[model samples]
Target: MGCDGGTIPKRHELVKGPKKVEQVDKNAALIARWNYCAISQRPLRKPIVACELGRLYNKDVVIEYLLDTSPEKCIIETAAHIKNLKDVKELNLTDNPAWKGDKVNTKGDKYEDLQGAAFICPVVGLEMNGRQKFCYLRDCGCVFSERAMKEIKTEVCHKCGKPFKEDDVIILNGNKEEIADLQRKMEERKLKAKLLKKAKKSKAIESCVKSARTEANALSSSSSSTSTTGGKAEKPGKPVSGIAK
Candidate 1:
């Protein structure tokens, strides 16, 4: 029976039960992570970079965040806790064959086959759509899959001929174990850079001291020469005075 202005209640409506929470769609989450900036959540544009923690971001947005002094405007506040721009590597992304650029279709549909992955590993062809692990070289900015890296096991980049150190490889969108390993690598790289900077500053200070000492010694020698010449000139003047015939 209906009560007031309400419709009839179902038999199950009278029974009390636990509330069911809506589950998040994994596909949507993956799509978002692959295409959007971790900090600003805007669609990633050219000059894309990855953090040591394996998060994707746009380079220009990162620069703006760094330049902005106000905390309110700072989107990548956690980025400050990061060492510097050196901590992030710019990605060398690959273009997908089946899709057009942002002018046509930036986002893909759920029903249709996903097209235009923002990035892919050059070595193993693993798309950077959050399916597999990927890493980029800090030295050459080349992207490659973790599997390819493990299989190849070389210090140099596969795509580029440039030499790279073990510290130059930084993972992007890595899982828990991979992320932990990446964090360790990041700390080690920063430590090495810090030590190098200190060594350079010490060397500069030593060089300055040496230069100053050399200049002072030259000045002292000049003063002594002038003093001896003056003494000789005084003797000559005296010879022309009372001692002169």
Candidate 2:
């Protein structure tokens, strides 16, 4: 249709260009990864746990998933790697004093800080809000910022003072390469456990077989000694009878 009255029609109005691609917001993605459980998509709460791949989850949700006989496909896919409680470590997160968590804003006009984190690193005091890299010790489950770890090089956990090796340090919400490395470590740990179990089983079987052989030998020797004693006694008795006759 022609423009109303003396109005001119712009070329943009007549010709529509290609639609702009809708991109995901970086802040929203960070919030999703740091604040919410990877499996249930619920807000992370106390007694939070993380898997081998460094995905954070609520302990209760993971327990429910493990107990479920027929879990939803999404849940199964998200937590398929978690076989038992041992697969996840309960995070020891330090509470951020500045963070007012889900508190009802008495002043309705006050702006909410979505970037505020619930936890922080005890050492460097960096918020664990996905802005900075964080890691937890597998030996102690104490969380600390990556910066703190690098600055203070020690074998013990900064928060709990528990000794840990280089392999025990697992990065939280790590990148694809870090996740792959963690996966390899996980497989190696499982393999070592299996080999240890097998060795124990074989040792037990060997012990049982040795004990059985010892018992059998003892029985045979006892029976042979009794037969020999009986033969000697019978021979002596026969000789005495012949002499008396």
Candidate 3:
């Protein structure tokens, strides 16, 4: 596939199912890659399969709608519902009646579900984290806790190397687990980039080898033709002064 203008033309809609059925409600456009547990913590990614509910939900609030209904339910969903962290102007939770007040007031930032999420109520809400935050918890690599923002003097994304709200900090538990996950994601990206570079270099070398072979063959053919032409150009001329015939 090639790009005609600045953007690549829509080649084919990568649907989740083998056959596109009107009965099935799915994002008929874009490709998705991951499952999102929460709209607030949607990984910076797109999922290929949009849960059946996602089809019924509005395009803007598909994730939020899903989150509100069943944070626990792994509804078939696509990643396209998520917006990038940088695009977020504000980070607010849609009150999940089922999971609400599960963990409203806790010392640590770790909570099991929306009930736990509700426990840590955000006092002053703001979107300081970049657009990537909306994609997914993994991609955003953010660990700003709403509690940390309230306790700390500054609101900055410790992971992203930028300033964000203490109350708005996307809180991952302050534990070795969070740190390790961040490190692992970073390492994964570095490895992917390295592999891609290596592949490109290998391809270039193969192309060079092919070109060299082509040029060699062309020269051999041209030389043979030139030799035959020279021989013909010099007429036999009666065997060139044969020896004392």
Candidate 4:
């Protein structure tokens, strides 16, 4: 109902109360913390915070969406750093029997999934202008949003054959480039290790040469002392204190 001021009374105002301030939820706070660590290069804290936060269902959803979206045999982060428990936890999100393939109307589907779904990817709860907009990663097999696809020059994803725009799409070929770079780095490291090993061996050989020279000097000194004693031994039978000459 309108007040005498001609403005409609809020639901709480009619009830003689003030609206409560919305606070960030605990799960979201945990996820935010994890993301902060990832961006900050402090993944060492990930396990501790993950243990404390237990599990985030939404995080699982995002992971699954990433896996389904990527053309490669998708694993989280880097392949060599895979931890079994972590991966299992991530992959199990799709196993939620409660989903039943229903339309993800959490807020609303923004993009049209012409290939398969309107929104197959899970939503990341990011807020803007007092409203939450979920972010999703598109699959390589699918076309970008009709409007987004119109603006780009790329015809298709090189890895998965999905059509895309130059801007809306992330190319999977960059990952291959990264892999190649890593391989080159590894080769360089191996070469460095081999050189260090050779240097160590050379140092040991040099030490051995010095020790051999010292041993030869000691042997020569011992032989000279023996000769001096032999020269002085001639008078031993004649007198105990007599000189050898």
Candidate 5:
């Protein structure tokens, strides 16, 4: 029977257990990330990567999409200035068996269900949905949880066999402090590259100028010598010109 006053109050009105702030945040982030691939407009999958601009994409998707460029292979950029696979380090991402993220949830999926999924770290199995720290090696591009890198402390890349140093590691979407450091490094590198290119162009110009000057000098010398020889071979102005002074 209904209460004499009115209907009963709902649990949400009375109970104050916890909030869904974290879940809502995660849901929004994943929706933004997984909506589409930047280059191909395809669904994101394993071995995803981010460019220097920090746009996420599937490695395979980029490869196929780049085929359209043909002879002029795609010139992609990342933190390490990638041009191709050689320039990019294949990410060794972990598989989240708990949540495959394959089944399309027409309706909004709960945040807890997508936890540690979509993109997980190979070493620590942590989700890359902005909850924790993660980094990719500039030399190899192998991504790993910040915790794993800190705890492991190895010189070699965990995904690839290539050797790397502490400086080769770049954090993905790091905090303000980390972003400041990365920004400084990127700016310094770009400045150095610009200077080096200018130096090369200047050297090329100088070489061309010197070559042209040398050719002009040789031609001038030859012309003068030819004229002098012709004048000397005039046979002392000949007998016909004897009347001349």
Candidate 6:
């Protein structure tokens, strides 16, 4: 039979084939991670903070999420790990001189460089764009490129001179393996803190019990001494009264 309007239908179109796999745009994903806040979905601003899992967020949004007791479900899921300001470190980012603000292409006629980053590594001067590996120090919140860290190894922060250990360095927007490692470290740290708190609480309870026992013993001893003294004193006075009768 002839097709409608004399249009020939291809065999591939008539017979359904296997569906093509949907792929995510790498550039868009990178922009989302590097340029936007994970919680509020707003553009990243100063006072940016990162969680233990290496998710970047604006400090104000994170604080708002923490303070809101009845937050939206998505906000809860996104920032549930952030209990307080202590859970996140405020990053000390260096401004990229070449990066014109996002307003540079407001007209939309000009070609915008997706790779332009607002911040860069203070140590190696590498842009904080998603192309390069970046890490922040938990101790001082100083950010540096992974290359600079490997090339110049030191116990103290390169930017702030604050001391930090190898464990204090947390990768920003890491891969699956790196994220899994970070999760494990986070769990271990939390477990250690919980155990320490429990130990301190037990110690305080033990001290209170010990003090209570000591006070009871002291009261009992004082009462026993007073009773013994009172029991021996009335015999002479009773004999004098009986002789007079």
Ten-residue stretch with the least lDDT total in model 6: 235-244
lDDT of each: 0.76, 0.89, 0.39, 0.38, 0.67, 0.88
Look at candidate 3 and tell me the lDDT of residue 220: 100
On TM-score, the stronger of 3 and 6 is 6
In terms of TM-score, the best-performing candidate is 2
For 57-171, candidate 4 gives per-residue lDDT tens digits of 2343334434464467545443223233342122111112222233556688644222221122222212211122111123322312223333433566433555554332322
TM-score per candidate, in order? 0.73, 0.84, 0.30, 0.27, 0.56, 0.83
Q: Per-residue lDDT for 61-173 in model 3, tens only?
A: 45354345455755443334333322222322223234432244567665333212221223333321221122112223333334444454554443454654322222221
Off by over 4 Å in 5: 1-43, 53-99, 104-113, 123-131, 163-165, 234-245
Best to worst by TM-score, what's the order? 2, 6, 1, 5, 3, 4
Error of 4 at 100 (Å): 29
> What CA root-mean-square deviation does each model show from the true structure?
6.1, 3.8, 23.4, 20.9, 9.3, 4.3
Model 3's TM-score against the true structure:
0.30
Q: Which wins on TM-score, candidate 1 or candidate 6?
A: 6
| Candidate 4 residue pairs in backbone clash | 152-166
Task: List the lowest-lDDT window of 10 residues for candidate 1.
Answer: 104-113
Better of 1 and 4 by TM-score: 1
Q: Which model scores highest in lDDT?
A: 2
Segments in model 2 whose C-alpha atoms lie over 4 Å from true places: 1-21, 71-75, 107-112, 233-245
- Of the pair 2 and 6, which is ahead by lDDT? 2
TM-score of 1: 0.73
In model 5, what are the clashing residue pairs, if there are any? 89-140
Look at candidate 3 and tell me the lDDT of residue 124: 33
Candidate 1: regions farther than 4 A off: 1-26, 74-78, 82-84, 99-116, 232-245
